[model samples]
Target: MTPSPGRSYPILISVILVGLVALALGTQPIKPIMSNWPAALNIAAPDVLALPTAAPPAAISGAALITGVAQAQGEGETALEVYMAQSDVQEDVGEGQVRFTRRDVAGGALELLVLRLDEHTNIRVINADGATPGSDERGDTTWTDGQRHLRTVQEMTTAPYALRENSELLGAIAFGFHGEPRTANEGTVVIDGQVLRSNPGRATLCITHERRAEIGRFSSEDLARCAQAIGGGPVLLWDTLIANPDVATAEGEFLPFNPLGEDFVQLDWRKKIYNGRYPKTAAGIGLLESGESFLVLATSYDMTGIDLARQLRDMGCYAALGGDDDTSTQTVWRGQLTRARDVRPVPAAIGVYVRTQ
Candidate 1:
């Protein structure tokens, strides 16, 4: 059964040095959990979680990033968050735990949260209600229209799925219910072996019950064994090539936008999101110096799928997929959420969490 988020972790030592400086200069040290995280995710609560950043990456374009620009920086927007497109910026949240990276492009900015996959770190798929996956017809009307169910991402990660220290969210871009009614989530969603929804044939991200990660067009047997899995795609970056990223749904339709969002959000249900520029988010595995790791990215401003794929490829991602474009793109890391326009509550998400065992 899914429970609500009702827990908090004690302060860790990584930020203590910064905290000491805060104490010395009479300034408040930055904490792992942000106070307004829950509110940012549209969750009604006293406490919250996060979405963090790292160093600014190589500029993808020639846009001058001069001013600080951030929609909801922690405690509020630091000047850096405001005009980040001017230069690349990143921060070390936990020395050996979760690493945050931020990069700026001409018309947009990208934030990446990296969590090493060891015995202690892992990933999971969350559904707003314990039972319904966003793609399923049984529920999650919030994505198709208004939030008639009143569920939040917080509820999606409650109780049996509560997080420990150092956790981050990856946008899978479950799907925006606009355009043709036939266009919906392309694949299936399976949590702990219980199939929440199913479309079967499509690109899939599978995390074994034992927590091994794999991405491919899996067979029925492969998907059934998955402990946590989310399937849908117009693959963003696959095998070093820009995979099929032009389609939005199983029907091969064009950008199917969320009506709640602006009409010019620049989204394509099919391949158009990749072809056009708009706020985007992506999730995939990266080949880091240490080993294979999971990475999530969010961008404010505007960017194309090609640029996003190149950026992920630049970051060493062997494979990646666009989560969704425009306001459907949101993330939470260390109690912080990425800044974007048309921020809407998502019914499904793939999150990185700390293992209690």
Candidate 2:
């Protein structure tokens, strides 16, 4: 019959070829479990299949200086808690570890630390350029001039110039809020027209009793209360202290020390004095008779009152007052060395006095 039409030599050859392919595949070696995969291809294997120990800590470069005002204590202990900034990693010096080199805000600069979370950072306070990075969305309605309107504003215009003006005198920055107690340092300390420099990272601000008063940062009414508590009184004239002559001068006169003090009383009976004299009046007191009303300078801390009186005596304006707390006040005023109508002549240096009104 035609050699059984269904079975041909070509068909048998095709079947054999298919069977060989199947056999080859079945006999091939099983891919070693991915754990056994070739070294070159196993880049991201889990621990069960890992070939090496844990990776070393990611290398960080010093190029990224994560700067923020240090809020921890300057205790110098390796507590790990004192050196951290406002973020996760803090700079510190441990047993053989080196923290950032501590540089003075200026010469004779001191630093303070705060431990509260969710607080505005020192950068935000001192950097006049800092802005809130988040958004605030609240719909509100107002009627003015017999009209109704809707407003959507995210950021509020804050006063940074004020902060910049008082930066040097400020020690820290504290957020000022309404309806708060006179918690931290709150009152105001009036100084001579000695202009202070406001530097970032080194300023200190504190809030007080007023509905909202932040000193250095912002001050509220509470500060007034603190000034009152200090037993405010008339300005004392002591010939022992003199103004810093290195500062600005006018008509051969240095700005008086604590020129802005309000309660001023000239206790010195002598005639003349140098502006930069300290509190030992050995010679004639330097004359601040510059005619400035608020020619007093404010200091971060207390000074030797008696010694200041002595210095004023050495200058021409010989006579000193023992008005300790009287030098403190609640009002803020400006004083200068110019003999202009608007400007008042600062008192002599050892002539630190309060102008009590």
Candidate 3:
């Protein structure tokens, strides 16, 4: 509404007085007006600003998981350049976990990639067999080779390129990628003749197994001052255990056909195939001497193993576990229950094999 000139004149005079007062107070709040008001009025520009966007989540995935520090390379590309750009992949590959699987597609197959973050993390991938034939790892150190094969599975799922017969260059590229990428063309790629690719980024490709052993948490030991505890116990018969940073969040916690529960209760797949306790996280055995229990602890690949061992020792722990491998020598439970009649000789041993008669 337009004001009457009589009232508008007073308003203008009041504004002028206020502006002068502000200037006298040395508080020049009209700097924008003084600097650009004339130019703005001449141009007739609207006084508005665009809003900003929210930051994306720290984690991003195209197809597979990127654990620790990782980068992806497409087919026929050299990942050495990408790997050297930032060595985060080294820590990630060396420290973190990833999982790869074949996914069936309409025309052929695709590959699924999953990555995990943190030590006790888990990532689950649905329809994880679309890009290549289902894989079951075999052999001792050959598991490393299996990890390399996962890269081809990833390429088949994500790349539009194909590998040349006996291509060393392609193999090198796959080995260089921390979270292996896969592809099709490497046939029998489809499983159950179905195409998979349900969730791209949502798929979990890594698992972190963190185990703890407390002195007061378990049974007692008879040795002079030695106890034992173990995670991933009752090791599989033919299947050896490796520190896998792949296979969703419950990688080491699960087995084929015995997936983890929604709440991540690792299924006792070993029970179905073996005769002992399935994979375990931590087990503690206390050394009882003079009615005082000395704690013994063990865990899987957790950096806190040494710290825990030290703390237990400080608390008079007889024996403890510490190492970077899943198969460390510190994790064990020694006693009559362990079926070892001569338990004194096997006091602080980890990775002990027991038969549940």
Q: How close is candidate 3 to the true structure, as a TM-score?
A: 0.15
Identify the leading candidate in terms of lDDT. Answer: 1
Candidate 3 local lDDT, 177-218, one digit each (tens): 011132111111111213211111110111112211121111
lDDT of 3 at 118: 26
* TM-score, one value per model: 0.56, 0.17, 0.15
Error of 3 at 67 (Å): 34
Off by over 4 Å in 1: 1-96, 134-186, 244-269, 288-291, 297-300
Model 2 misplaced regions, further than 4 Å: 1-181, 184-290, 293-303, 312-357
Better of 1 and 3 by lDDT: 1
**lDDT for position 301 in model 1:** 48
Q: Which stretches of candidate 3 lie over 4 Å from their true place?
A: 1-266, 273-282, 295-357
Taking the tens digit of each residue's C-alpha lDDT, what string does model 2 give over 44-71? Answer: 2221211112211122111112111111
> All models: lDDT?
0.45, 0.21, 0.21
Residue 86's C-alpha lDDT in candidate 1?
38
